[model samples]
Target: MKIVATEGCHLIGKNGERWIDGMASWWSACHGYNHPHVREAVTAQLQRMPHVMFGGITHDPAERLASRLAEVAPDDLNHVFFSDSGSVAVEVAMKMAIGHWRRHDRPGRTRFLAFENAYHGDTTGAMSLCDPQRSMHARYSGAITQQFHVPLPRDETTETNLDRVLAEHSDSIAGVFVEPLVQGAGGMRFHDVNTLTRIRDACRRHDLLLIADEIATGFQRTGKMFAVDHTADLPSPVVPDILCLGKALTAGTMSMAVTIARSHVFDSFYSDDPGAALMHGPTFMANPL
Candidate 1:
């Protein structure tokens, strides 16, 4: 369908047929369309600056946004890396997980343990992290790096299987990748907080990094700042070592995503040696406008 215009939460087509934007522009337009506040900010930003390279040159909006993200992010996830899309954010999280181990001299711990019926993104690296059997990217299996995909921890049997998989592949598994309470795309599946705790416990027991892909559930979509915040109710609250956020980050005003890491994860790359630094840098990483 051709969306000629959008107002509030509805889309207007060529024939002026209006339809509620139920999906929120693929779950990114959380604030609806043509919001005056958003428009004003964009207009003001445009008058001053639209886009600028984030390499060596720094800008106020990017710095302020980075600080705001750190302030609102769960736990000590204070470090942020920006990208232009959700898929790229997920890919960055994957790279961070694998690189964390490699920097610590455990290069063999390379692959990730992601859940079945989970969809991270469509990029080659992110595609492999999705459900290998059920994802639309299944046809590209041979082209992407294969990771471990297992069932969500919804029951004792599945939980046991998860434990077993982690135990058996502990040496090779760098981390656990999950969508937290709700899984999107592969299926709009929802698992309770206990299931999340089980995954967190398993990751803790095996000493593996936990990467939460909140691309679909961030910005209070799931009644929480981020889906991982539900874990705060557990006896021992848990947080992911790395968190991926996107979709509503700009409230659909523009395409933007972020991969945030905790202090320890960020510290691994903080060394005088140039090789120890995180090597990847996107061109439009922290576009001011």
Candidate 2:
């Protein structure tokens, strides 16, 4: 039979039986389906202002959400790059990392490092940072940039492995991408916070940018506002150079995602020459309805 409606955490199928939605609609519907509050908000939004392209314009929902995010984000991650979905958010983060290095005059540091069994998203650039042996896009290996893969550490001691990986490829590494404490798409593998802290330390020591893919762990899903909040073992709180977020940006009401970076990272795109500006953007980049 087919499910027709949802309330609270239960779904009502055609048979009239109520069942809990264990997967939460691919893990994005934190508030579940047919939630009264969500329904009202969406309906109200549709009446007032339904759709708007963000290519060069802004709307109330987008602006309010961006402001809320900046207020809640970690220090200096005040900038927000909006996209339609998580996959696109990942692509934005990757591009920002590359641009950050290029703008800083480190053009040769173009390679990226990600953990084995870590899944960022399905986009081409996101897929490249994923370990092909464990990623679904193994067949499309030739299309990706072939990032270095570090095995997820089982304990704090595994910091040595991260050090070794950085030592071997520090020169070419542009950034180190991670899924934080829990590697969601990789069968929900859980690692220690110290492991993330170590990775962060290694990235800083080697001058590599740290990109936290918190798409799955944002919005208190993991009992924290962001997964990086769990990393208290580091000498200081580790703030990623770039952060990719989605799924809960608008309480899952709208299809929205954001790529937040430090101001310096954004500065790279500022130039007198039009060609020097970051040329990558979707047609809906700043569209407003």
Candidate 3:
């Protein structure tokens, strides 16, 4: 089953047999494979500039992409930080949440509360946010920071339990992390708008941040630009303070991901203090390609 080539929505095997790309390269190839337009864009950019360090230097592609992402993102998530993968993007989001609290004088708010069947990413921070009992990172339990894991609030009782958990751990909880409507890696679990609304209300009640890991549900995978968009009809509407996007971001062409934050979260770091900035940096972050 070795894929030698990819064209349109099919994969060419070693025996020249064509197979449908059912998962679209792990949900990254949104426009199929080898699309002429995508190829043209990649080629043009490749010829112009393939890679550049995104430290003090910036490029048009990065700025344009960031602006476009800000325009399409839900709510006022305008600040974007680029990363090389979804896991790292989730890591960055966790940092943003923790840093936001630390800058505001709540350094103790370092842990996250996530679903019992959630899958954020494989990185250290993101892995800690995944399902503690069922995720692949269970073997590394002692190696990672212990966080609160609760069941999805599908019913009033469960929702109340979530509230109780938040009430008990709100002080140390940096925020609530969720994969929104569908928990892709945590068994493709699906929850409705009511569930999302409950989570949002809980966060609001506890005055905690909400981090939505949309890496698998972003880019219309769940019939909306993001899974969080499904809750847009609620009376107050669910708006995550931080959003993590990846996988389909580069359309399977290259590695790219972004962590977007609302103004309040971004404002936490908006200071003249040199130590106030996010110190993490990925060398391949914002690669021109």
Model 3 per-residue lDDT tens digits across residues 1-289: 7899999999999999999998998899999999999999999999999999999999999999999999999889999999999999988988899999998899999899999988888878888988878988888887898899989999999999999999998889999998889888788889898899899889999999998989988999989898888778867888899999999998988889999999999999888997999988999999999
Instruction: Give stretches of model 1 more than 4 Å off.
Output: none
What is candidate 2's lDDT per residue for 55-139, written digit by digit as tens?
5566776677678888888888888887777888888887787777887888878778888888888888888877788777778
Candidate 1's residue-wise lDDT over 1-289, tens digit each? 9989999999999999999989998999999998999999999999999988887788899889999999999889999999989999988987888889998888999899998888999888889898988988888877788899899988899999999999999999999999988888977999988888889889999999999999999999999898888778777776889999999999898889999999999988899998888877887787766
Worst 10 residues of 1 by lDDT: 280-289
Model 1 TM-score, all chains together: 0.97
| Candidate 3, run of 10 with poorest lDDT | 228-237
Please report the candidate that would top lDDT against the real structure: 3
- Give candidate 1's error at residue 111 in angstroms: 0.7
Off by over 4 Å in 2: 154-157, 232-235, 283-289
